[model samples]
Target chain A: MQKTFKIVDEDGIHARPATALVNTATKFKDTEVFAESGGKKVTLKSILGVLSLGLEPGDTLSLIAEGGQAAEALSALQEVMVKEGLGEVQE
Target chain B: MDKTALSKDILKLVGGEENIEQVTHCMTRLRFNLNDNKKADKAALQKTDGVMGVMINGGQFQVIIGNDVPVVYNELVKNMKGSPEGRVSSSSADAGDKKKKNVLSSILDFISGSFTPILPAITGAGMIKGIIALLVAAGWMGTTSSTYIILSAIGDGAFYFLPIILAVSAARKLGSNMYIAAAIGAAILHPTITTLLGAGEPVTFASLPVVAATYSSSVIPIIIAVWLASYVEKAVDKVTHASLKLIIVPTVTLLVIVPLTLIAVGPIGVIVGNGLTDGISWLFDNTGLFAGLLLGGTMSLLIITGMHYALIPIMIASIATLGYDYIIPIMMVANFAQAGATFGVFLKTKNSKLKPLALSTSVTALMGITEPAMYGVNMRFKKPFIGALIGGAVGGAFLSLFKVKAYVIGGLAGLSGIPMVIGATFVYSLIGFAIGIVVAAVATYIMGFEDEPEAAAAAVPAATADANASSSNSAVIADALEAETAPKVTEDIYSPITGEVKPLSEVNDPAFSEEIMGKGFAIQPSEGRVVSPVNGTVFSLSKSGHAIGLVSDNGAEMLIHIGIDTVKLKGLHFSPKVTAGTKVSVGDLLMEFDRVEIEKAGYSTITPVIITNIAEYSSIKPGGRSAVKEQELLYTVQA
Candidate 1:
């Protein structure tokens, strides 16, 4: 399962949101979650990998999850993104 | 100690702060766990100031920082905002992920870890002891004078109270509180304990008979005590609650460990220490000269493997229990021999860089540290090292034959400790020093091992090129004799620059096109740098920075010219490493040139490499296509 989100927060996906995203993704078992921006993809659970993407305000990101729990993991990750005011979900 | 820049530079060299998973220090090195080792700049880190050496051992990137490791480690941790707690235990567990260490590394690691932290105090005391011995021998100081007594206290105190220092370091290495470990060491050497032992009174620890072993100047006891303390401390920490941890942990640890140490640890350590000392003494007594020769010759090799630390227990034990040690005297010969070898290389090496290194390292080696001399000079040239070994063996044998022994443990492997060999006959020490140095230097000079590659290269050419020249001079018989013994062979010559290859005749300059500078091909180089095309030593590198003459190990002499009429530019567009006798392998970087600047200076950057000894070859032909890259076969010579 994959979904696109437009970054609404002026700070973008900085440390706090990156940590939140990683913490949410790690809660799921056997699901691979990835955040890709500007043609670069990184494991969402890795803070360093996500920060390396350098996502800024107005930048679009594709959140991807693969495995048996892919849809559920992706939905949890998207819910945190919206609740944290990091991005607006675009299904 | 306030080396912010050095720590910052280290982080940069080790792939920046982000790449570092954790940074911890032990004795002489900063152990780092990196996220990606591939990102590390090993060459840059090695070349960085304050970094003694860099190594990747057991999945950890280790930077050897020498004695000031704690200070540097502090700055490194502060800069990275990393904790220094549990570093040794964590790293050891990380090491456990790999295959277990062989017996050799395990012993080395244990010895080095226990001794490295206390090296400064030991070395300082050793040097002071050496100085006192010198003063006493010179009649400048009385044996029982107040000044002498005070100095002796300062000099001998470290050796006498070694357990306290070893406890602190060993506890750190073993992941335990240093103070608690030190408290245990202090208990073993307490005034009450010493008095009881001196009084010949039977003592008991909670009804268990206490072992009457003197712990002063002891090496093994404190190490064993602290190692045991780490486990006891860990168990105490596990059982104790957080609120009661501070008082309960240490009190329980001391209560359990103090008695255990007196009954088991000290007695066992005494046995082990005595066994080592006796074993060494047996070897010296039974084998005599042969034992000295063997120990002296192989000491440096032990240093290289880091097993030299294992010998420290025996030396200290011999000094403490036996009053003198033969090992110390033999070690002195080994140090001086290494210095002598470096001095020999300084006189013999033709390499510009190695000469200065040999000279400086020789001086430092004379003062007692042989690492620079060993790693940078003698070992690089095998013959010089063998010369040193032979010299050490001879000198050591002489010292043993004369029954020479060191009354005081001296400082690092250097001349600073010469005065410590003041036992019975001091003259033997003097003779051993002189013979070790002179023999090693003379042997290295006579052996002529600095550049065997160049000598081998020169030998073949002396016959073939001379025969070619002599045949031209109507000495046909000598030429026929040379040819009968030596067969004609073909060798490949690679392009030194990357570009479009052009025949020498097609090059614009008449001097090159007309074959005035011998026969070869030219390349209109796209890259600015020039690389060596053969494995050889540079015989002649022109001062003009335009040409380099090299002779391969197989005696193939080749010349590389940067540009036509470029020599007239007075080297403005060129920068070269023109050390005339530098050894270079194929694809080694020789120099960088400004190709655009050379072209703008009204000179074509069509570089050519010509075989100056063209007459010795049957034919020289173009090896491949017009467009060539560096290391591509540009010419083939059939001799």
Candidate 2:
């Protein structure tokens, strides 16, 4: 399962938002989550990996999860991204 | 570790603040002149977390701390109680060292010490003059244009007012008030005095006849005047009351030194300068080729003994009075010869470790800074030094035969300085430069020396193993063995800036010094350029354009922070070459900044390169040398 989100925060996905994304990914233990941007992908569970993407304002990020709870994991990540004002889920 | 903790640790290891009689720092090292060298623990300091290395040279204990030396030095000052200013009286402590040094070495030390600090300003002004000469010669700039007039003033100002600058440096060296010395210099060059001297009439000061010689652009007069002023200032200070010292000391010093200089010392200095110039002119005029050969062949020997600085006044005097100089051309040939020999070694050496050093030093030598090439490469292999001497002699003889002269004081003595010579023999000067390089390189290649042994390379690790054994670090030994035997996964991190690479712990910022942000290295950039070290995507960039983050294709996260606290610059003098989220391959231009302007605005250009995802790697080893070129291997991260 995958969902695309647009970053809205002025500072982009810096340390705080990166930490939030990592926490959301680790919550789904059975699922493997990765963040993809500009054709580069990194494990979403690692804060450094997610922060390294350097996602800026108006940039699109795709969250991918592979497992039985893949859809649930993507939904949780998307909710956190929007709730933290880091991004909005793409229609 | 933070500066406070690191400074405290270092102080204890060096037998506390009481042992330190004096302390100073350059870019990367903290130099401490201890009261007793034996009191300092060299072994323990080497193992300290923040210290990269420990060395003792010239009776001073030097702690290598990379870029954060100034901050650590400040912290140490705060911890010391004996001297609030972090400096104890050196007169008594230096007695032993002074007794050991002979008179010749002491004089050499004094001359070199006084001249070294002001070399940057001299070189900068000299290069500007050389460039302007080139532009005028090429006819791109007219000699009468306002642009030319302004540029000439900028280039000529340093030489015209050199006495004031020299006074400051010489005063500092002699432990006297620099401002008083500057006032003495100014008095001699004052308009009233110059007008009197220019009137073609005799001048008198306090019934004593003053010399009508000009002091502007002259070297020896100001140096001698400052030397005498130092003594007068010291003597005046001794009798002045503490309450009235501020007003009485300088007042008496200027009153005594200025009149004395105008009447007696200044004329003697001018005669000395003229004598030296005449002596050199006679040598070149009487036996041109032989004189050049002797000077060029022995220039390196003079530099090693610090006697080269003693000749600087003669060069300046020649330029000021004679309108052209022969010494600079001979010196240029010697420099090129040394560079050529170093390049030859770079090509012939089988040692991979020595090759890069030779290549870099050779390039620096060609640019007119030959100390590294001379000491690090040519002198190391005895044959190369002989080759340089032979090449220098041949090139010198050729140039002397044609009587080529440098029309301007060019900062660089290399190919770039070819424009400095601008007479009928200009083409011959160029040929002499090329011959210097060609002959030296050919000679060094044909007369090869013994190559460094492979056992010498392997002994470095053995020494580390022995240190670990002495400390009884068994776990480290086991890990080392495992790393050697195991199928290790490693990634290379290349340098993003062309400069000297230092340990990350030397960064002034605690976030970097303590390794809280990550493990990495720092660079004292020579140029204002930053490039991508990996085929990566730009992760983030600070709004101020002072910092950039990147993620490699292989998942290595790195942060390159340009300069310390440069964000305060508000993006001035800094331009982002690429925006965040852009893809950049290795060696791609990431940012451009005005390094010279940034430095003028009071900011250090030492950049830190950190691996933000250091937790994912087991070990990160920095390349064990100071000089690093862009795209060179900086670190090896083992997973």
Candidate 3:
């Protein structure tokens, strides 16, 4: 299942910030959670995926969660979003 | 995206695939000629990285890449492979555009484009003259005093040598060698020739009797000389620069050119100048108000094309023959009107980004320059320009009514001529100026502006418009999910404007307050005739009239949003039938606004129509903006 969130950061998370989120999320096993912004999704670990999002500062996104740590991984990813202070994590 | 791809994306964003015409750099802007002004996504451009702002002026798209504008311009041009002088796509073409422009629009465009670059010089000179005049009047320096003479000379230098500047500009316009053209003009204006002419003897040039006119301080002769010079240069270039022809060819050409010019070009140019002045005088006399309205309405359009330079000869001729011209004074008023209208919208709107454009344009307009404002903001919004047109017509008519005139021939049709105009026409000109400002401000206030519709349409995504409709039509749909006894009352849903109403849930977006995304309920009514749910105080309403906020006596905060993305509609479809703090009964029609227009604006009528103040109550009921009698239970929330 996927839920949407609005990107809140002014500059938006560039490649570095997107990598931080993706690399941190890949730590979870068998739980595939990916973020899609501006209607395109990127792999949780692929830096290319994040940059392809072309997510602007005010852009919105959807986070898709599935598999084993889907819920836990989603929670951890939401934490990164909260830390980076962009996008509201859906309940 | 990598940095290269990012910049590539930026170029594509400007309009990919044959939209850009020419790319030129000035100061910090990358100016492009677009085939269609409407095709490019303006909002996206504003938010794009490396773009400070976007300015549309003189039929050109100006992107402010700041100090690195040169780099961006280079990058954009390199990828473009040289933008050919090709027409834009036919699908995006404007209507009824095949006919050649009549003399008027052509004249306006000529004058505007020619003067825009030279304005700084005129303003500086005019201000110096104004200061010197003040000093002379104040007894600090006599008119013939050395201090006064030096200062006045500084002020008058450009006007004295005006022929040279006009020659260079005309030569460039004709695509000829400019310096040679300037030299020909200088020959005509030589101080020695002025002495011979002052002696009042007919000088024979190659046996054709010459008009011994002093060409110094003359404007029209250069335009004619350079036009003639262009043909001569082209002919010379065709022959040869080989065989040591460089110095010898130019020298012989000048010898042939000077005699021919004095006898042929100068006199004919003077006659053309007089004819132009006569035509203007005829227009002012014959048509009066009709002329005023037409010119005033399209003044900004002229300035936008940079064609306002064509007015120079007429102005100089008027000064030569009548000692004054009324046209420049009226034009200045219209110019100010354009700025004033933009300023009005800039002040009235809630948007933060539009304010700087308004302020800068307004300030620039006050000084009698309007391209920055005209291109930057006024034309972008549809209604503000109408306001400018209205103000311009009124101002122009009033000036004509008073017959205001300017004696001095400084910066023809520019603000610098205001003092001379005031001196010639007095209280009438000043009053006309005041009238121009007042009319512009008032028209802009009343006419208002239309914000770009796309931003409001995309405010919410597509899915919410449909799902909200499903939850709204079926009470069982509401009951099956989380049923609460909504206060039931049946009243008539009358036509707000005798037009159609649509169900909010049936619309496209999925997020209203309660239907798809939020805890609040939404309604898909048959139409958009919003009636009062209960007696309430009108709270917050946007100036645009798209969304309204209301407070019930019991403190139920409700937001009666008019349409989805209707904010972009910018008052085209919606009209607030009521002001804030208006009282209403359950069945009383609170507001009458447009519903189909909301849909046409690329938004769904699936208005969340939410009870935002539901937190104040144990539970609140939801209602519809249409199809229900007054006092119907739309929905309720329990506190």
The candidate that wins on TM-score is 1
lDDT of 2 by residue, B450-494 (tens): 876644444345545334322222222111212322233557888
lDDT (0 to 1) per candidate: 0.73, 0.75, 0.58
lDDT of 3 by residue, A1-91 (tens): 6666777765465433555676556566467878776556656654334544656557787778888868777777778887878767544
Candidate 2, which segments miss by more than 4 Å at Cα?
A: A1-91, B1-95, B131-150, B321-323, B346-364, B367-369, B407-427, B451-639
User: Model 1 chain B, poorest ten-residue lDDT window?
Assistant: B473-482
Please report how far candidate 1 places residue B129 from its true position, in Å: 5.6
RMSD of 1: 17.0
Give stretches of model 1 more than 4 Å off. Answer: A1-91, B1-40, B49-103, B123-156, B197-204, B285-287, B346-357, B417-419, B422-425, B450-639
Alpha-carbon TM-score of each model against the true structure:
0.57, 0.53, 0.47
lDDT of 3 by residue, B53-95 (tens): 5545434556655446556666666666544223334443332
Candidate 2 per-residue lDDT, tens place, A1-91, comes to: 7899999987677655676787677767679999999898999977667766778889999999999789988988888998999999887
Q: Which 10-residue window of candidate 2 chain B scores lowest in summed lDDT?
A: B472-481
Looking at model 1, the pairs that clash are B368-B413, B368-B414
Model 1 chain A — which ten-residue stretch has the worst lDDT? A45-54
Q: In angstroms, give how far residue B504 of model 1 lies from its true place.
A: 34
